[model samples]
Target: MIKSLLIANRGEIACRIIRTARAMGVRTVAVYADADAKALHVRMADDAVHIGQSPAAESYLVGERIIAAAKQTGAEAIHPGYGFLSENAAFAQAVIDAGLVWVGPKPASINAMGLKDAAKALMAEAGVPVTPGYMGEDQSDERLKAEADAIGYPVLIKAVAGGGGKGMRKVDAEGDFLSSLESCRREARASFGNDVVLIEKFILSPRHIEVQVFGDSQGNVVHLFERDCSLQRRHQKVIEEAPAPGMNEATREAICAAAVKAAQAVNYEGAGTIEFIADASEGLRADRTWFMEMNTRLQVEHPVTEEITGVDLVEWQLRVASGEPIPLRQEELSIDGHAMEVRLYAEDPASGFLPSTGRLDRLAFGDATRIETGVEEGGQVSPFYDPMIAKVVCHGEDREAAIDALIDSLADTEVWPVRTNAGFLVRALDAEDFRKADLDTSFIERHGDDLIPSGEADDAIWSVAAQIAAGDDQDELVGFRLNAPARHAVWLSHRGEGRLIDLAEAEAIAFEDDGDLLSAVDTTATAYADGDRVVVFSDGVGYAFDTAVRGSGQGSAADGAIFAPMPGKVIAVDVAEGDSVAEGQRLLVLEAMKMEHAMTAPFAGTVKSLTVAAGQQVEVESLLVEIEPDEG
Candidate 1:
C-alpha cells in the first residue's frame, strides 16, 4: 500500500496525478523549480519541495536531486508524470535504488522502448508489426538517406528518442530529404538531448491511432482501447479521444492486441502507451499499421482514456506499484462514452503560434466537464517549460455531444492579458473538414490559413469600445439632458485600426450604423479618462476603449521589416558597420526570459546599422535585424 507519492513533474499533469492520488487516500508531494514556486500544482499538493533553479537542466532534469527530495519527504513512491525525466531510464533506476517505489515501468522496459529503432526491433521480434525503416546499428547519414531513397519519397526522418513531434520531419520528395534531416536533427538535439534518428516509410493521409496499455507486477497487461490523435500540427497531437472513431470492432481488438504485445515484449509494468500509426485511408487494417513507439509513463491526454473506460490511470499506477494485480481484465473493460481533450496553451495563434508569456491577470473557466490546470491568476508563464496551461476535456454519450460540450466550454472560458489557442480550437471544431470527419495529421497544415483564428478584435467590439469612450454605458439608462453637449467624438483603437465615431448622447441614442442599432442601456456611470482613451467598467473587467489615432511613421529603413525573432536578451551582435552578408546570415542572438533566438537575414544585403547592442531585452516584433537592399 502506497501511502504517499511525489510527482516529479510540473503543470497540468502534476495537478492531475495529485487529484487522483488524493482521491485514493494517498498523499501527494509536488516538486517545483524557481519559476514554479507559486504554481497551482504546488498549491494543490499536500507537500511541496523546492528542488533547484529555474532552468530544467539545473532543476527538473536533476534526477538524483528529485530522488533525494522524495526520500527526505518520506514519499513511498515517485511518479515521473509524463515529460521531463519521465522517459529517462537512469531516473527510473535511481528511484528504485533510492529505496522508494517507482510508480512507472521497469527501467529495463524504459530502456527497451526509449529508442525508436530499438523499440521497433523489439516489437518485430515479439511478432508485433514494425514499420519499414532503417533501424540498424548504422548511424551513417548516407546509409539513412539511401534507406529513405529505397523506401521511397515521403519518408519520415524521426528522432529515435522523439515524442511530441519535436524531432520529426516529413520529407515529401528526395530533393528535400537532407535539409529536413538536418532540421530534424537540430530540433531533436534541442528537445530530447538525443540526436539519434530513424527513417520510416511515410503512410500518406494516415491516422495517428494509439492504444492505452496498462500492466502490473503480476504479469497482467491489458489495453483500455485506442485513441485517435490524427489532428496534429507539426506532428504534435492537439486533439485526442478514446475508442477511436471510425474504427470497427475487429480492427479495434487487433490494434489493442498489437499494443499489448508490444508492451508485454518489454515485460512492462505500470501505465504505458503504445502508439501505432494506422493507414486510415484504407480504414483500420492490421497489416496497414506499424509500431511507432511506446511512451513509458502516463500520457498527457490520459483524461479521455479515463472518461471512456472509467479508470484512474494514476491510481492504477499507485496500486500496481504497491504489488496489486491489474485493475481489470479484457473481459471487464469496455468503452462507455465518447470523450475529447484539447490542449489549451498560452500562445498566440495568429503570431505563428509563438509562445505567449505574461501574468495571467484574470483566469476563469466555468464548470465544464473537466478543466485540468496547474496555473492560476497572477501565475507567470515562463519560457523555461512547456507553454500548455490546461487540458479541457468533456465527455458525453456520443461523439457529437462530446464535441458540442467541448465547444461550449471553450466559449465560456475567459482568460485575459495572456493570449491563448482557445479561439483557434473553437474555429477548428467548427471547420468543415472536422465537422465532416475529414481529418488527418495534415489537417492543420492544409486548413491552417483558412482557420486563421487571430488575436485581432473585430469592428463591432471597437465600436462598443468607442461608445464607452464617449460616455456610453451598456449597463445604464441615461436620460438626455438638453443643456449638455449634443454630440461628442468617440475614438478607439482595435485590431490596430483607428476607429472614430461621433455619438449624440440621449435617453436612447436612436441611430443606425453598419446595420447595428445604437442604444444606450446606461448613462449614470463614472468614467476615468486616461489621455485620449477611457474604459467604462461594467460586468467584469469591462473596458471600452476610445482613442485618437496617433499617425506616425517610425522609419522607412530595413528596420521596419526586420525584427527580433523571439523575446530574448541580445547576447552578441554578429554584424556592424555596413557589413555585407548573404541570405540566412545570423545577425544577433536575443536571449529572452532565457532561451537564445538568433535573428537572421532573409536575403543578401549590406548591414546599414545595428539598432540594438548586446544584452538588450527585446520583444518579438522589436527592430533588431537591419539590412540594405541587395545589389545586382
Candidate 2:
C-alpha cells in the first residue's frame, strides 16, 4: 500500500481522507488556506502545508503550490478530495510528473469528463444513453436557440463548465430562452471562468441516480451500487441515499453494470461516480436512464455507500494506488442495508438560502449514525468557505427505518449562529410524497413549504417567553428585590416581528398583549435557563441569548433598509437618480463567497439613496439600498 498521501483539499473532506490514510498505516499531509489554519483536518494530519491565500483561485487551485507541498512533505501520493483540483487534468499530470502517485484516476480520465459537452459526446459513442440536445460549441445565441427549438421547448440551458448549479437554467418557453441563456452564460463565466454552454432535453420529473465505481491498475473495475440524489434545492444536492427506492433487482444490476462499463471505457482508477438522470416519473427502470456526468474522485455522499457495504473505500483507494489487485470481485460485493445522508448547511432557507456566518456558539448533535463536521464550539462559519457545517448519515436495516433514524438525529442537533435546514428536514421526512418515494430534482420546489416548518416551538416554552416578556418575575441575577413583584418590560424579536413582553408574576407570566401573534408568523422561539446561561432556539437554530433581553430594542429606519446578504463585492446597480421601484425589485448584486446574490427592495418605493459601488466588499447586514415612499 502507499506509505503516505497528501490531501489537496480543505474542511471535512480533507479530514475524511486523512482518517482513511491513518487507518491504512499511511501518513497524511494536509494543504490549507489561511482561514483554515485552525481547521480540524490540519490538526489531525501527520503533517501540514499552507498552500496560498484563502480564496480557492489563489490557494487550492494553485496546482504548483499543492505539488510542492506534497514533495516537501515526502508524501508519495496526492489525493484530491472532491472539488478544487480533484478533476483538473493538469493538476493530475503535475502530481504524476512530480514523481508522486496521483491517488485518483489518470489525467486522461479527468480530461475525458472535465467538460459536460465533451463528456456527453464520449458517452454517446460508448453506447451509454444520453439526454438528447445540443452539445455543440457554437455559442451563437441564434444557433443555440435554434437548437433548443428543434429539441423542443422546456430544454435545459446549462453551462458546459457548470457545477454547484451556478450556471444552469430551465426554459419552458421560447420567449424566456434567450434571457435565461444569458444569465447562465454570465454566471458560468464568473463562477467557472468558461462561458461554454450546451442545451439538453429537460426531463420533466427526473431522479438523479449515480453509481459509485472503483478501478485499479490491474484492469479491473467494479460498481458499488447506486445512490439516489434527487433530493435537491436549486440544483444542489441536499440529501442522498443508496440503493434507490423502488429499484428492482434487475434494474439495479443493469445500472451498476453500465457504471462499470463507463469506468472501464476511460480506464478509470481509484474512486469515481457516474451520475445518471432517470425518468423516475414513470418509476426507475433499466430503459429510462441517461448520462449526466462523472465525478472523478471521492464524493460528498460517500458515507452512505460506506455504511451499506461496510467497506472503507478510502482504504481501497490507497491500496489500489499502490498497484494492488482489486480488493473484492464484482460478485463478492453486496450491500448490507439502507443508508441516507443529509447535508446540513449554515444558510437561511427563508431568505433564498442566503449564507449565514458568525461564531459557532454551540453545535451539539446526537450520535446516531455519523455526523461529519469541522467546526468546534468556538469556531466560526466564515463566508470564506462553504456554509455547510456537516453531513449527517444514518444507516438501518431498511429504507423506512433509515429515514426515521435520520429524522430523530436531525431533531437532536443544536446549531447556533447561522440559520440551518434542520426544521425543513424534519418536515420533509413526515411528508406524504416523500414517504411514498415520489421525488425528483424539483421535489423541493414543488413542496418547498411542506419542508419548511411553521413556527412550532413548544407552546410551554413560549409560555415562558410570554412570561418573561410580561415580566412575571424580575431576574434574581441583575434586577432582584425581596419586596415587590419585579415587573419589567423586555423587548424580544423572533420570526419577523419584534415586541415587548412585560410581566410581574414571579413563577408564571404571559405576554402583555397578544395583539399581533409574533410566534404565528415568525419561527417558534424557545427559551431556557441553565443556571445563569440562557439558551434559545429560533429559525432552526439554537443560540445563547446573552444580553438578548438587555439589547432587545429595535433599530431606526436605517435598520429597516436593505443590507448585504453576504460579504461579496457589488456587481451591478439597478437604481439611478430617484427611480421608482416595486417590491422585490433587484436593487443591486453582491458577489461573495463565489456566488452572486441580488439585494431586492422590501416594498414598493422610490430609490431614496444608494451607497457603495461595483467591486466594493461589504460585511453582512451592511446597508446597500435605501427606499422612500413613492408619492407620485
- Where does candidate 1 stray beyond 4 Å? 178-195, 466-485, 502-632
Top lDDT hit: 2
RMSD of each candidate relative to the true structure: 7.0, 6.7
Model 1 TM-score?
A: 0.81
* lDDT (0 to 1) per candidate: 0.76, 0.78
What is candidate 2's local distance difference test score?
Answer: 0.78
Candidate 2 error regions (>4 Å):
137-142, 453-458, 464-533, 538-540, 543-632
Error of 1 at 500 (Å): 3.3
Of candidate 1, the 10-residue stretch with the lowest lDDT total is 535-544
- TM, every model: 0.81, 0.81
**Per-residue CA lDDT of candidate 1, range 1-632, in tens?**
89999999998889888998989899999998999998889999999999999999999999988998898898999989988888888888888888999889999999998788888888999999988888876868788889999999889988988877679888989989888988998999998798889889998878889899999888999999999888888778888877687888888888889999988898989999998888778677887888888888888888999999898888888889999999788899999989999998877677677776766755766446888888888787788888888899999899888888887777556564556777788778778778667887888888867665544444434444555454444233222336774344444543224444544323233323322223223421222444555533221122324355322322245332466534456789988857988888888776654555677877888887677888776644455756776868
